[model samples]
Target: MKYQIRHRTHYRYTQPLRSAVQTLCLTPRHTDTQHVHHWQLQSPTPLQPQTDAWGNHSHVLAVGAGARMLQCEATGMVETLGTPLQSDPLGPDPRLYLMPSALARADDALRRSALAAVRGVEGRQAQALALTALVAECVRYQPGRTNANTTAAEAWLGGVGVCQDQAHVLVAACRAVGLPARYVSGYFHARGGPELASHAWAQVCLDPAERRWLGLDVTHGCVVDERHVQIAVGPDYAACAPVRGVRSGGGGEQLTVSVEIIPQD
Candidate 1:
């Protein structure tokens, strides 16, 4: 399947910002399951492209003084293989994902729930699926209840959050049981109502030696498929956020994001 994706983000601030520097992870990743044909980014300033420590394609955008508004757009074409399970022969060591990040640290209650979910599961894939179901059941998809900084422990305890929270809980749960799992940020093409085009999921490493992984969408309680396009993989959402920046001075800001994923074929 081929897709044309457009993502636009705009920011309005009450006060002009003196200066700002942003890190962007908006580019889709070239992996065994997907191939990037062409990708372009448009911003107020020039973008410096670089690969992050986790091998994700990223960019650095710098804005000078007296900026009251900021807009960034990304357009791309990609082809997906529609394979939910894949092996990353050239990715970072799978062991690196075993330790949960701060935003995905599992608490004692979470650990116990994870253990009970996979207690009788046999294969790694089955256990991962069980965990995915557990996350979906434990965390109802409720937007506005959690923000970007919400942690897995908090979301699980509250039992309400969006896809990001679900992914964090899944990653934390997988790591609690000695399985290596990484957070995935991407785009999802939904056929109908309410689901955001911008999505998040988890990829569990089944065989570290073989670099085999299974992509799980805890929000939908299923494996990732052709509708999903990979963007970045990291320990948590903070590491793979589409855009993160700091400015010298910007009082009260409002942000708007629009994402469109059209099927080309």
Candidate 2:
């Protein structure tokens, strides 16, 4: 299937910004599940872009005019394809090793929630997958219910969040239980079921015990397959944002955003 995507993000500040810096992880990477045929980004400001350590395309955009909006508009054409056995999964294993920054964020609630998910599982590996399902059952997928700072324990407590929040909760839960997990920002193809939305999910590595990486969307209650299109993997959302920035020269500014994802027939 082919898709055309249009995304616009705008920012308005109370005061004019002399300069602005931003990181953009909006480009999709071709994987076992998807391919990017064409993509482009139009920024109101010029940028210095680089790929982050976590594999996200990063950017630093500067603002010269102090009174206009800061915006990013992008369009792309992509194809969702099938996975092949010869292809390897992206990122590191979770069951093997997880860093302190990643694991330290877990609280009692996160641990308990994740543990509860695996309590009924028969196998360790399958336990992780079950945990994913538990999270989906626990939280409602409603965008604008939470923000980036909203943690796993918070979302678990609230029982709702968007894809990013869902991934955060699951990542925190997985890491708290000694699983090596990372955050993933990407696109998903829903086919005839639903329209596409900018999506976020989680991945775990099995380390030496099992040489495999698994992708899970707690919000969707399923493992990522050919319909999934991944863009970045990191310890958190800060590592893989479609567009992030601050402006100093703009004041009393109004902002609007629109994101559309549709399947091409």
For residues 204-257, could you state the per-residue lDDT of candidate 1 as single tens digits?
999999998899998876798988899998999999899997888879899999
Cα displacement (angstroms), candidate 2, residue 258, comes to 1.7
- Candidate 2 C-alpha lDDT tens digits along 2-121: 778887888877876677677777777666566789988888757677766654555667667564557788789878764411132344444333653432256787678778777766
Full-model lDDT for every candidate:
0.91, 0.70
Worst 10 residues of 1 by lDDT: 188-197
Clashing pairs in 1: none
Model 2 Cα shift for residue 5 (angstroms): 1.8
Best by TM-score: 1
Candidate achieving the largest lDDT? 1
